[model samples]
Target chain A: MSLLNNIYNQLRISHKYVNRLFKERSCYISTSPIMRDLMEFFDDKKNWGATEVKTGRSWTKDDLRIKSNTDLHKLWYVLLKEKNMLYTMEHEHNDQVRLFPSPERLDKVLDSMENLEEVVRERNRAYYELETTEIGEQTHKTITGPFGLEIDYYETEHSIPKEVNAQWQKEQNTKCRPEDVKSFLLKYKEKEYLQNKKQQRRNFNHVIGLLNRFPKMDMEALKEQYPDVDIEKAKASRKYKPPLVFD
Target chain B: MRLTQILYTKIGEWSKKYANLPDRYIKRAMEQVYWRNPKGIQYRPNTVVKRKKFHFTLDRPWSAQFAETNSPGRLHPKVFVEPIKKWSFFRGDRVEVLVGKDKEKQGIVKYIVQERNWILVEGLNCKLTKLDRGGVKIYIQEEQPLLVTDQVALVDPSDLKSTGFEWRYTQSGEQVRVSLRTGRIIPVPASAEETRDYKAKGLYVEQPKDTSEKDLGEVTFEPTLKTFEMEIMDQMGIKEDRIPKKSYWY
Candidate 1:
């Protein structure tokens, strides 16, 4: 049996209800006045040919937090509507080859929605922590990627162990090659070395240039700009000769 | 009741005058048409008529000619509840964008295109739109405000001052630590000499040379929260339309 499948089975044995809750919430669709408003996220049939549509701002984190859960639910629809409107506008814009005005509005809404979800999750965590000892059960598993980097995989309680089950195991393990690894490591090191060397040379050159340009360089400003460089040694260098000759 | 009786009498008289036509049907059509297509009369164009008609001869070149500029202009019909003259919002009222990067960005609405649902805010970001076939279009819109609710700063009524005031970070205003949007506390200097030093060095770098150069621009001097109060107000466009004296800052 795969380790992840085993973990999922174990989790299912304990917190089966929470998993159900997540599934239910994810699938649940609201059809209310607020939801109707949020459905505005979709473009109208009449405006299908239009390349652009005007819209207001996304709901702020502060705005969402202050509202009661009921209000939040309603506002969710509002935001959802705005998202649909933006999507429709974006789709039309792309189709007609026009610039969608305030494209950042989409990102803002997405950010706001994400933050709202995070806040809800935080509340849910607190509630679960109060009732149950754990912050619910975080489905976490560590696995090496194709590049040999370790990543955590969240586990959920399921009927069967993933690794033991052929289908789940296929989903878990991804394909990787030894030659690709060697090449990746080589290129990664080379890139790292280049970046460091470039930064070092830039700093060294800047120090030399500063000393050359401003012979009586402000001690504080110069030191602040290049903290690692030995300012005294840079000043003493022949390259540090100022444009004005000393009388 | 008395007004209804008079209308019936008038209708009866009109029916006898034009006896051949159906009086009730004609009255109903007139009322329905009046109810449906009532448009406010505002601007009108005058037409001139020529007393004599002129004739022109056509050349028999045997060439077919087709009119190309026959595409109808596009328009979205919308009814305005109020007239433009009645709208109090003026061109000079400064609009300050209340969000990041463009926060406190102030501009005046140069022209209000009521029919088009557009306002030309001077100095705000404007874009020239190019159509697929040809020609360019211009559009102006307001910056969206930051979505926030609980992060609103609460001020104590007793501590209100003309120069300096107290602000709490949390919604409840019970917490001691305050978080500024700029991610730093308002600096308060110790003396007049320190104040001058702070202003000279404390000036935020408008544009840093590079990411590494940010640390170099950090000012050693600190100014009091009082000195920085006006800067916030000036940047926020509060001098024109003062923030409510009692309302909480969101």
Candidate 2:
């Protein structure tokens, strides 16, 4: 029993020594020399409490389109890190009751990320279109709902076939009473009609105001601006008085 | 879908050009949202009650002074602006004053407020105002905006006289302002491209955080038949042996 205990102690010391050596080797094997500690989640120290942190505009879609997939993949992470850092800095500043400098930086990063994603999606779409007849995007369809309003329904993956799924089939079949649907649709249509009429009236009045303000204003430009408004009818309105002529 | 969007569109593109700010930033800085419907099952989903009409003055739309002028519970009188087919006035253009005390005086265009069809000519159309500072009344000359339509006329570069100009295409398909009388092309001034950040785009100083121009200009993309995902996975040495199960999409 004493010998067995001594051997166990020897094994434990070796294990400890091996762990220390492995850790020392890991320190040398680190990919980046700059330690990626928690401090990376914050902005540069020099930028702290700055009034304005000037930066260039966001990356354009055309710029990202020329980058390789690997470059885009790397850029995605860089932008993600920047976004996280900005958010952390913003939150910290808000907590300290300090003004966050250059809030537009966040927007710029977001815009770049959006453009990068769009470029990636475009590349994917092109490949899919070449390989298959479809665009290979999530499928969706517009269908009339129970209230007779058009609803965009995105297709989702299901374990069972749609025809065999009784619960989904029932949900799809669920409908309001015909009379109730008719009443709802009628009210909806009336609301839409009133909105359109109000828009037309507003356009007519605005055109008249323009005419009253600038007598020699370009009529062609006015017509182009307010395409739905009847220019002649608006001119005939009492509110649209013709400019007085003086010799 | 919001009324504020339509109203914001009234801000002319030329007015925003000199600011060198993103459209999103301008919209964010200027927008005054009094109330917004809370999320989840709202009767009018995404309905926002915001300031629809903004009083465009000499102050820029994104400035704090402009925000204060259009602050909550404040409504200015409706301003009727004449719509033009195209904006002709730009910064740094030589113009002759057609009205007021500075009539017939030629000055370079200093500022533009295109929403109101207004321009401020340098050292012209001055309004002297007395300011009280620490019991001392100081008289300062302030530049007032002139109506671009009737109060100012573009100066003919050849004759140095006020003349009407028409936009015409040059032999190289470049649009240019041509003097109606002299038939000489009034080239767009280099200062017209000047923004708050830089005198010109090429002269812009790169910030520390900005990507280097060399990196931006590099073309590293190779024509690959694989999709982005496939290319990325290949680079990472990730292989998928198991095929995804066929599932019904409904």
> CA lDDT of A229 in candidate 1?
70
Error of 1 at B136 (Å): 20
How far in Å is the alpha carbon of B56 misplaced in model 2? Answer: 1.8
Predictions' DockQ, in order: 0.00, 0.59
Instruction: Categorize the docking of model 2.
Output: medium
TM-score of chain B of 2: 0.91
Which prediction has the highest DockQ against the true structure? 2
Give TM-scores for every candidate, taking all chains together and pairing residue i with residue i.
0.36, 0.89
Q: What's model 2's lDDT at A63?
A: 93
lDDT of 1 by residue, A1-247 (tens): 6999999998887688887787687556555434444445555555555443333234445544544444445556666766777788788788878766545457656766776776555555665666675675464767565565555555665555554567666765555688887787788779879977776665666678756655544466556545667877776777777688585
Mind sharing the TM-score for model 2? 0.89
For residue A240, what is the lDDT in candidate 2?
86
